[model samples]
Structure formats: structure tokens, C-alpha cells
Target chain A: MRELAKMVIVLTVLSSLSGGLLAMLREKTQDRIEQQVLEFVKGPAIRKILAGAANDPIADRFTLADGEAKRSFFVGKYDGKPDVVAFETFAGGYGGDVGLIVAVAVDTDQIVGVGVTTHNETPGVGAAVETDVGFIRQFTGLDIASGPKVTKDGGSINAISGATITSRAVCAAVGKAGDLYKRLKPEILKQLKTFSG
Target chain B: MAKTVTQEFVKGLWAEIPPFRLVLGLCPTLAVTKTVEDGIGMGVATGFVLVCSNLLISMLRNVIPSKVRIACYIIVVATFVTVVELLMQAFTYPLYLSLGIFIPLIVVNCIVLGRAEAFASKNKILPSIADGLGIGIGYTLSLAALGAVREVFGSGTFLGNPVFGPSFQPFTFMVQAPGAFVCLGLMLCLMNLAGKK
Candidate 1:
């Protein structure tokens, strides 16, 4: 009976101490961890798509209900007006769902730029889109509402010679982004006002 | 009680080095040794947990009941591992991504529990600390050595830099899982041969 009681008391004390220590650490690191994730995982692509923005798009961000799921959107200011927004969209690729960030001009309804943020496509073939500057460049200044597509699909954008599926996936992702933008434009504009100052 | 602090510490470095002499905690040793950076990061993380947990366990040795000591050790070790994980996510996000699930797995690492049960519970505070440091650093060094061997041969690069020349063809096999098994086996063989002398 003495041993059992001792065991219970010791275990309880140790567990509580451990919990307290971990809780303190978690609180201390929560904000910084969120910041680091933003800076590393999504920063490069946001910076590239919102190139030459007057403000840091990665820093100037907002999330809104796009249905049941809340999706984040990055804001880009050009000449001091936040008129372009970037958000991620996905479509099936050769290996998995390809994540593409499509930046659209709110005022002109044209694509500011597009960048491939994540993908699992074949290297040197489908995955080439990551650094295939010319391929992604084709989407710049294109009308977002037209639903971007490849030349083979009766669209002007030329697909990479060997990665038709990945090219189609990118185009489909951009189209999805177009639809998302149209759905969230009102909430996004309202959110952008908070950053306008 | 008879062993000095220095003796306890030094013994961990070579005589009972976690991976080679004791032949334990092979999970992270094989998985993260693909790069010197990863190896060092994992080593340092594990070392921090080992030292901290050992110190705590040693301090609480008398208070903890023998029946619940393992439970107490786990709580202590888990708290430190979580602290390391959160801190890593906050400051070293890239390394955190590379190490991934292995950081949490440190809870089950026999080295920590083994030391707590076998050495720390029976030792003084100073000796426990020394033992933890020695073993932690030993683990780090072993990981770094294995990582060097694999990275140089597999990727033809050291810590992301080209080691030989651009012309040197990478032995792709050394970077995969099977290569990890072979590399670890060879290292164990070498350690055994050296010990025989």
C-alpha cells in the first residue's frame, strides 16, 4: 500500500512538472514558429509572384472563408495601392496535387504573375516548372477570367514540350484561382483595407 | 558512487558511445545521416534532451518511486524533446522540416531511458550531467562522421557544396535508404574492429 501510494504521487508530480515546462515552451515559441513557417515555406514564391511590390506581400496577408475552409491570400501593393492579390490553388499533377500561386490584378483582372509553390512531378520533366522561367512567364499579363489553358487545349499558353499533364495542371490551378478570386473579391477587398494604412 | 565525474563523462565518448559501443538509437543515426548538417542538427537536438533529462532524472532520483521511474523518465525526456522541437520550428525551420517526425521519436530512444534507469538513477548530479554530455557529444560525432562518408560519396558534395569537381559523378545509391543500412553496418564493423585492438 505504501509503495502504491508513493508511485501514484511521484508519477503525478513528474507528469505535472513536465506538462508545465512544455506548456511554457509552447507558448514562448508559438508566434515565432508561425513566423518562420511563413518566411521559409511560402515567402519565396510570394516574393517572386508579387515582384517589385511597394509592400512586403508575405507580411501583408489575410485569410477569409472560401466556403467551409479558410484560405490565406497575400496582398501586393504597386505604386502604394494594394490592387493585386496572390493565393494558392491546386490541381492534379503527374505525381500529386500541384500547388500554384496565382497573382491577379484586382483592377485590371489580368494576371500579375504566377509561380509554382509546390509539386511532386517528375524532375527535369514535369518538375521543371519550378525553375522554367519562360513557361510560368507565359501566364503574366494574361486575363484571369479567360481560364488559362495550354495551346493544345485551344489556349495561347504553350505547354512544356514533354510535361503536358503538369502544364495542364498549372493552367487548371490558375483557373481555380480565378474562380476563388471572384468568390472572395468582396471579403478580400474589405480585408485589404486594414492594410491600406 | 565510486566513479569520478570525469570518468563517467569520458566513458560515454568512446567506451560506451551510444551507437557504436552500446549499439542503440540507430533510427535517427541512419535516417538523418544523409547530410552533415542534418546529422549535426539531430545530434545536438538529441544531446540537449539527453543532458537535460539526465540532469532532471538524477535530481529527482530519490523522490521517484522505483515502480514508476520509467514513467517519470519518459515524462522528463518527452518535455525536453518537445521543447527542442518547438525551438527548432521557431529558429531552425529548414532543419526542422528535414528531421521531421524523428524529433518526436526521441521519446522512445533507449539511450535516454537507459541512462536514466541504468546510470542517472544511481549517480550524483555532477556525474549524471557529465555522462549525458559525453554521450550526447559522442552521438553527435558518430552521426557527423557517418554523414560525411555518405554525403561525400553519395552526392559528391559536403554540406551542399561540391567537394570534388563538377565532373565527379555522384554515387546516387549512397543517398537512399538501402545505402543507410549498408553504411551503418560498415560503421558498426569498423567500430568492432577498432575495439578488438
Candidate 2:
């Protein structure tokens, strides 16, 4: 019993020390990390999707509460008005979750663009969701109420060659984003005023 | 005694080159080496975890109880792996996204645990550090070589840029899952041939 107690104590101390050190490191790197993620990972997709916006959408971003989760929205300005809001959605894909950044023009209620932020679909097959711009362009000007779907499912959006599952995943992600936009339209419109050009 | 430290470091580069020589940590070796960028990123991250864990494990070698030592090593290694994961997510977000689940998977990498059990737990701090650096760098180089070969043949590109010009058709077989195994197998054969020489 005494030897067991000693062993437990040693393990506990080691664990505690490790935890404390990790906590300190995390606290120090938290902000820099958040900045880096925004700049490198999601920056390109947001920029591409909101190409014509005058304001830097990534910088002019805010988070909104939707039930238990907080979702981030990037505001893009056109003609000095914050008229577009871009947000991310994750949907089930062939290999894993496919992340899509969907941007909507507040005044038009039409999709500005859609871009794949993250995906694990097979390269040269399902991964075409990220590489094929023509497919992605089909999302532009889509009305939020219509809810986009791939052509195989009786919708207008055409699935990529040999990548029907990934194409469906992209549609699913956009569909989720459209739902979120509809549910949070009032909140999103109210918050848009804060992001002035 | 004078050259022992140098020997330890040099052995990792050639005689004990991981995946190729030691044949440990093959998961990351295969999964992330699809691109040179990913291969180097994964290698460097693994090296950081290895070096830090080795140093800590060696420093606490005498203090940790034998029964709970493996558990203790895991905690220390996990702490470092988390740190790397956070840092990578922040600064190298693209690489982080590409590497995906493999980043968290580093925690279970046998190389990290193997070194702690075989070397760090028995050696002094300096030798352990040397061992870690050598092994980590060797792993990095091996991954890079594999990544280069795969990328060049599979995509006809080097580091995502067209290396073979437009006329060169890519041999797509080298980039898929089957390609990783075939490439690794052929690499092992080459290493064996070289070792005999």
C-alpha cells in the first residue's frame, strides 16, 4: 500500500507539472495562433469568395450566438456599405467533413460565392470540390430560399466528374449555410452596422 | 567517449534513419508525404515532440517510479504534442489543415514513445538531446525524400509547381495510398542494397 501510494503521488505530480506547463504555453500562444489561422488557413478562401468587397472581410468579422454555438461572420463592403457576410459550414463528405465558406449579399439575399475551406475527399476525384472553380461559381447568385443541391438530386448544381459524393458534401455545406443565414438574418443584419468601411 | 555524442547524432541520419532504417512512425511517413510541404511540416513537428519529450524524460529518469514511468512519459510527450498542434494551427494553418488528423495522431507515434523507453529513460540529458535531434532530423529527411519522389512522379510537380513542363504527363499512381506503400517498399529495398554496399 505504501509503495502504491508513492507511485500514485509521483504520477500525480508529474501530470500536474505537465498540465501547468502546457496551460502556460497555450495562454501565451493563443492570440498569435488565432491570428495565424485566420490569416493563413481561412484567409484565401474568404478573399476569393468575397473578391469584389472593398473592406477586408477577414478583419471585419464578428461572432454570433446561435443556440449553444457561436458562429463567426466576415463582413464585406461594397460601395461603402457592409452588404455581404461570409460564414463557414461543415458537412459530411466521402472521406470526412467538408468545410465550405458561403458568402451572402445582405441586400440581394443571393450568394456572392462559395469556397471550400477544408476537405478530405480523394485527390483528383472528390477533391475537385476545391480545385474546380466552374462548379463553385454555380453557387453565385443563388437565392438562400432555393437551397442549392447537386443535379443528380434534382437540383441545378452539376456534380464534379467522378466526385458526386464530394459535390454532394459541398451542396450540403451550402444548404446548412443558407439555413443559418435564414435563421440568423435579423441578428446578422443588425450586426452588419458595426462593420463600417 | 569524445566522439560518442557525434556518433549518436550521425547514426540517426544514416544507420538508424527512421521509417527507412528503424521502420518506426510509418503512419505519418506515409500519410503526410504526399507533398514536400506536408512531409517537412510533419517531420519538423515530430522532431520538436521527440526532442522535448526526450529531454524531459531523461531529466526525470531517476525521479519517475518504474511502474508508472510509461504513463508519466505519455503525459510529458502529450503536453509537447498539444503545444506543436496549437502552434501549427495558428502559424501554418494551410499545412495544419492539410495534415489534419495526422497532427493529433502524433501523440501515439511509436518513435516518440520508443525513444523514451529505449534511450531517454536510461541516458543523461545531453545524450538524450543528441539522440532526439539526430533521430528527428533523420525522420524529417526521409519524409522529405519520399515526398519529393511521390510529388515529382505523381503530379509532375515539385512542391506544387510544374517541374516537368506541360507536356510531361504525371504518373498518378505515386500519390495515392497504394503509392505510399509501394514507394516505401521500394525505398526500403534501395536502403537495404545501399547498406550491403
What tens digits encode model 2's per-residue C-alpha lDDT throughout A1-197? 98799899988898898889878988988988887877776889999988888888888999999999999999999999998999999999999999999999998899999999878899779988887989999988989768788988999999898888898898899889988999999999999987764
User: Over the stretch A55-143, how does candidate 1's per-residue lDDT look in tens digits?
Assistant: 99888888888679989899999888888899989999999999988898888889999988878899889999999999999999988
DockQ (model 1, Cα): 0.83
Candidate 1 residue lDDT tens string, B78-189 = 8999999999999999999999999999999888888888988988899999999999999999999889999999999899999898799999889888898899899889
* CAPRI class of candidate 2: medium
Best DockQ among the predictions, by candidate number: 1
What DockQ does each prediction reach against the true complex? 0.83, 0.64
For model 1 chain A, give the 10-residue run with minimal summed lDDT: A188-197
Q: In model 2, what are the clashing residue pairs, if there are any?
A: none
DockQ of 2: 0.64
- First chain of candidate 2, TM-score: 0.94
Question: Against the correct fold, how does model 2 do in TM-score?
Answer: 0.86
